[model samples]
Target chain A: MLTVEKVSKEIDGKKIVNHVSFQIKQGECVGIIGPNGAGKSTIVSLISGLEKPTGGEISLSNRPISSWGVKKLAQQMAVLTQDGLNPYPISVFDAVLMGRYPHLSFFQREGKKDYDKVEEVLETVGLTDLKDQMLDTLSGGERQRVAIAKAMVQEPSLLILDEPTTFLDIGYQLNILSIVKDWQRKDDLTILMVLHDLNLAAQFCDRLILMDEGEIVKIGSSEEILQEDLLSKVYHTKPEIVRHPKWDIPQILLHYE
Target chain B: MSKKLFQRDRMLWLWIPIFLIILLIVMSVSVSLGAASVDWKTVWKIVFSKIPYVGDWVTADWSDSAETIIWDIRFPRVVLGAIVGAALALAGAIYQGVLRNPLADPYILGVSSGASFGAALVIVFGWQLFGVGRFTLPAVAFIFGFTTLMIVYLLARVQNKVRLETIILAGVVVQAFIGACLSLILALSNEQLQTIIFWMMGSLSLTDWSYTAVVFPIVIVGAILSLFFIKDINMLGLGEEVAHHSGVSVQRTRFLLLILASVITGAAVSVSGAIGFVGLVVPHIIRLLFGSNYRMILPLSIIGGAIFLVGADAVARTILAPRELPLGIITAFLGAPFFGYLLRRAKREYF
Candidate 1:
């Protein structure tokens, strides 16, 4: 559904993303896994149109990303950035309703349809009770939930989530991923998310893209990408790979080396 | 969200009319309390007589001076006060949204300092725009006010991109430099020192229809133009990447909003001589009463600020009777304590 060809980004003579390329089919949830400074987030940003790649092209379906208008691109894709939203006095419901922004015209107010979608998403994200509360008053976990609810309400064809589980607890991390995975299954949605926890990525993603030093080192299923030698080579540490006892999914284990 | 009358549609219905009514009441009571001591009856008749479909329904026992006070002196002062207040408050709200900083105000940039410098030049050297007229000081002040913002914007831009921190840094630098220049000018020049000093402190005294004529179009048109950018402004409050992902041309929107809002603030300061807390406090108060949505906050701040400043200017005119205070003093005295009260009541750290 999405193709990123030989994309490259440079900042002040430093290569942030260098000639990276990947493609994900429809109904796929792909995880970008890497250590710090691997350009995983930068690649996702390039795909999301938040930043333009200095070299190479990205396309959705068949058209170049540059040809797509912002509102059109927004309608097709939703992004959950790692940065915290500003601490304004916007309420939870209002914050979630901002997802409808790209859909509505400049002067058009959010209607019953928009509100209904927001309500449904709020329920899905388990934030219905706190919809009226001020956003700044929310705990970090609650704020992450709100951000996820916002992305869900956009109802986009593709979702790009950067560090979605950063502020979440283990329970909510599992819960949010399950909810997202279920939504992807139901809608045939394409997801490209950045995750630090390789175990969660192995469990949730259909395929993994491993990055190192602004380059793609490997891209395959968990069985192919989670090898101990490959992981150690990329992570610069020794690691062990084991399967989930019940799910037959490969998970990472750190070594003392 | 929660079932409250304060959200979306109900907010438009509930608070706007209430503020409009309060604005009317305050304006009515305000014009009557000036040094001339016009009664409420005279004030009411003079105000109502000007409205359509009610021109001749009243007794005609009022004198010419009373009419002059209502029409020539007090009416213009009141309207000009509203314009300046609305401009400042809307500018404040816009700056806060664009910069995504709750503590920002119209004067947070260099508008006030630039205006003071221009007015100081006219005061210190005794020169006027085109060698003398009622509009000389304000005209020079307006030009200087606008030019300073341009310089600040230019200084803040790097690689044709403007960062929020750069803008704030540039604003602080320009403000300090201009403020120092103003102080030096004040110290060096002896004649007309009181005039320069009082203008520096800020006031609404000596305003007339001429001042109103200059400000009316700029403020009204600027505010209406701001409405079209409401979506962009709202998106901007989210982080830049979020706004970009949402399809906002973040840089273009930021630049347009900054220019429009600064223009509004410059116009207000040129005429009113830097009324301090109206811009800062009105938007804050509106966010507290309503929400932070600029669609509501902008309009409400317009009226809310109009009411606050009219009443404050009235108090400035009458609080000490024969000895009137500057409008800035009244606002700070009243706004500071009220802001403190709001802070004590607020459960969040909005600032």
Candidate 2:
């Protein structure tokens, strides 16, 4: 559904995202895993057209992303960046309604269909009860759910999430990932996410791409890529890779400093 | 639960009447209490005489000095005050939304300084460069103000994206440069020193029908232009990239808003000569009362700002009676304490 061909981004004089190329098939959930400053977020920004790649081409479905007008592109794909916190006292419902902006023409009033979609997304994110509550008054996990509901209301074919669960507790983190996984299965949506937790990526993602120092070092399925030496080499730290006793998924045990 | 719902409904109904009464009382008191101490009865009589068929009952004689004073002098001044105030406040709200910064005001983008420089140049040179006949100084001021913003805008644009931080910095730098040039002109001028000083200090002494005519149309146009962009402005309050992804043409929208706001500020400053604090305080108050929805906030800011400014001007003119105080001084005096209170309150609430 999405393809990146030789994408490179340089800032100031230093290379930030270097010669990265990858593709995700239709209905696939791909997780990009890397340590901090590994161009994971940069890759997402480039694909979303938030920043122009210094050198490369990105295509959605088959058309180059540049050829898609902003509104059309927004209809095709939705993005949720890390800094989604709005300072205003917007309600969860109104915040989610913002996702329908691209679908609206200037001076057009939102109809019942828009409200229905918002309601559906709110229910999906388990935020129906908190719909009227001010976003500033919500807890971190609730706010994140509100953000997710907002992206869901876009109803895009492709969803890009950048470290969405970073601020949530472990339970909420698992809940969010599980929600995304359920959506992937139910809607057959194409999702590309940047995740710091390799184990979660291994368990949930259909494919994983490992990046380090602005370069994609490896890309494969969990069983093929989640080796002990590969994790150690990419992260520059020793880690023990063990198999899940029941599910047989690869899990990592990191060595402390 | 039923009782609670009833109470909530009652409160909602109660709010409209209470606010309306406050607005009415403020407007009436502001009109009647300026400079010359006219009795409430006399003020009412003058007001009634202006009405179509009721003039016979209110006017005992054809030549009523009180009617003329109320209608001619104080009334127009009050109206002008309202329009200028509302224009400044609405511009402020729009600027804050476009920049996505709560602290931004209408004058923060160097528009006001640009206006001052324009007015000062016309005053110091005593030349009508635009050849606009009698409407020379103000026309020149508007031209310079609009041109300066265009230049600042062009300077800040990078690859078609205007950075908010860069624009702000550019505003500050240009403001300082223009201020220096203004000061140099003032230092060199030997004859019109006091006139220049008075103009810079800001006064509504030029409250005439012609001045009103020039200012009102521009202000109304600016306000209308701003109203159309209310949704785009709301999206902009989120951030530029998000707004762009949401189908807003961020750069083009921002440029239009800035130009409109600058024109509003220039027209207002040309007439009133830099009345400080109304733009900054009025919009903040409106935002606090209503939510951050620009659709409601922009209109409210215009009305609320006008009321606030008219009320301030009334106080300025009446307090000293025969001797008029500058509008800027009164605004600064009133606005500083209110601003302090707001800051303290915001800190307590947010922190």
Candidate 3:
């Protein structure tokens, strides 16, 4: 449902996203993995229409992303960044209810249906007990969960997660991704997430797009993309790859030389 | 779960009536406790007697001087104070919300400085706006204030996005430049120096019925327009990106809000001069007492601001009795230390 055709974003004189092209069908979760400065976030920004590409076009369901109204596009997609939300001292429920902005007209306060959506999403994110809790007082994990709950309430068919697990602990990381997993399954959601952890990327994503130096290195299933040779070439670090004991997906292991 | 939600909504409902009562009481007290010391019963009787049909019923047992003091003088001054207070507070809330900075205010945005500069020009040159007479000063002030906001907003925009830090910096620099020009005007002046100085210090004492008539509709209309965007302002507290992700047109919303806030502030400053802290401090107090929700903060700030300024004006005129202090001085004395305390205790985010 999403396509990027030779999209290139130039900042100053340097190319942040250099002629990158990829597509994700409906109901698929694709992971983009790379080292720092690989322009994964820029690609997400372009697709989300937060920033325009200088060179090429990005389209959602065959319509140019720029052609869609911001609110119209928002009703179809939601983007979450690594830093999550600012610590505004808003109640968790109110923060989540903000997701209904696109659905309601101007001067229309959130009615019963919108409130119900927020309540349901808060329950799903296990934050029902903390509905009255202020966002700034929450832990990093909890705040990200609030962000996720907010995104869920947006009810977007396409979800963009831009390195969402960067500051999270391993446990919270798994919890967040699992929540997204369940959400995708239930809603038939399509996800484009940038992941720093290659092992988690292989485990959660059906397809991986490995990138290097603002260019797409390869795109394939986890088995094909997570090969040690390809990863070492892109990341400039030698690592061992082993299959998971249960799921049999390729997992990366690193050791001090 | 639904019951809890219902309870929260109901709780919010109770505050409106509560604040309205407080506002009414405070206004009444402010109107009564001026230099002449009118009694509460006399105050109400005089106030009620001014109402159209009610005036027919209320016996005019009170002296004409007392009626003049209540109706012609204190009543309009107090009402003007409420209008200016509400405008400043509403503008402050919008600035803080849109800029995503707690320190943001109309003063921070150069709106007040620009208005003051325009007023100073009128005072120095004695411009009557080509026979427009009494309103010429405020009209020129409004034009300058609105223009200054546009300039500051444009200066801060980079790559189609307005960074909070950049906008604050832009406003401060613009304010400094305007302040310098105003100082130059002050230095070159002869007879109008005291008028300019006292006007800069801000006072509600000079206000009459005409001033209220000029400012009332502008603030009321700006406030009504602001209601449409309070939710958008709330979304902005999550930052522009998240607000955009949730479908708020951040740039357009920011522009409209800035214009609306500046227009309201321009009107208030035109009539009241640069009353500091009413805008900056009132919204913070509301957020501290209530919550960071703009839906509540915007409306509550209106009442809270009116009460704060009216009360401050009362204290200004009556604190030294015969020798009245400037309203701005009163506000700073009360608002600065309280704001400092808020800052010191602000370990929890109030934004």
Summarize candidate 3's per-residue lDDT along B179-226 as a digit string, tens digits. 999999999999999998888888887778998988899999999989
What does candidate 3's lDDT look like per residue over A154-234, in tens digits? 899999999999999999999999999999999999999999999999999989999888999999999999898898898
Candidate 2 Cα deviation (angstroms), residue B84: 0.5
Candidate 1 lDDT tens digits, A58-176? 99987898899888898889888765566656778888888888888877877899999999999877899998887777777778777778877778999998988877789878877
Q: Spell out the clash pairs found in candidate 1.
A: none
Q: DockQ score of candidate 1?
A: 0.57
Better of 1 and 2 by TM-score: 1
| Fnat across every predicted model, in order | 0.62, 0.33, 0.85
lDDT (Cα) of model 2: 0.79
Error of 2 at B104 (Å): 2.1
Winner by TM-score between candidate 3 and candidate 2: 3
Each candidate structure's count of clashing pairs: 0, 0, 0
Worst 10 residues of 3 chain A by lDDT: A86-95
Candidate 1 or 3, higher lDDT?
A: 3
Best by lDDT: 3
In Å, residue A115's CA in model 2 sits off its true spot by: 3.3
Q: Which stretches of candidate 3 lie over 4 Å from their true place?
A: B1-9, B341-347
DockQ category of candidate 3:
medium
Candidate 1 regions with alpha-carbon error over 4 angstroms: A255-257, B1-9, B124-133
Whole-model lDDT, candidate 3?
A: 0.88
